[model samples]
Target: MAENAANLTATLQVKPSIFEIIAQKSLNDILQPAFRKLAEVLATNFPKRFAWLNNYCEESFVVINWLLQYNYLKNYDSTFSENFYGFKRMCVDGKSLSNHHIELSLLFIVLVPYFKRKFDKKVTLYMIEEADGYFKQASILGTNLRRKM
Candidate 1:
């Protein structure tokens, strides 16, 4: 009975995982208004490139929240690809991630992938156009050659 009590205490004191931290709706509630404003900023500053975010902000956030809830995804380093973000659990011992860091991480992890995974042709076209334009500019400068597929 004492061992059971000790185990329960240990479990209770265990640190929350990054997923658990991100899943806290309190942080979401505090930061989402700012995030919505960020959405506006993206739409305003890069109207041609990111204007589609305005149409899908709420839905995109819903998807992000859903992804942050899964335990299995917490440890996944590749394939799903959270490694692109700043905060890894191993590096964060005895420290806390700033709200800004977490917010950007969520944006990269979800928003970037959301565009492609939806398989929306329009999104694909936009990316292709941007890539082509960028590569063309680079080729003109002799920095790199654009290979034709």
Candidate 2:
């Protein structure tokens, strides 16, 4: 009985992964007004984009809540992606009009796998950053690129 108890204690003390920590914190913050606003924007401005955003938000909520409930925030880095534009103009137009600059970072992390699955030679994921005000224009660039494909 004592040996079993010790094992249980050890197992309970195991550290949580970083992804778990980020997931938990994300859950706690998921209901914030900012997140809702972002969701609304996605639903209104770009219905097609809403599918991915919804998946991301749901996943993030689950991950963040799990971390917080288990008190594992200190064990992980909490980085998450935020989409700059949605279907509605309210979310990004003000920023675009404010002289905000948009910066994009392209990552090849999943591109190779995606390309392989599609029997294509290349794929790319673009990360976009913009000053607080110019998100709309940046999103426009993303839309244009998507249309070109």
Best by TM-score: 1
- Compute each candidate's TM-score over C-alphas: 0.32, 0.21
In model 2, what lDDT does residue 70 have? 27
Whole-model lDDT values for every prediction: 0.57, 0.40
lDDT of 2 by residue, 100-142 (tens): 2111111121223233534532222222233433667767766
**Candidate 1 lDDT by residue in tens digits, 36-135:** 6778899999999878877777665656554662322344422122333322333255454444545555565556555555567688889999999998
Which candidate leads in lDDT? 1
Which regions of candidate 2 are displaced past 4 Å?
1-31, 51-60, 64-72, 76-149
Following a full C-alpha superposition, what root-mean-square deviation does model 1 have from the true structure?
13.8
Q: Where is model 1 poorest over a 10-residue stretch in terms of lDDT? A: 77-86
> Any idea what lDDT model 1 has?
0.57
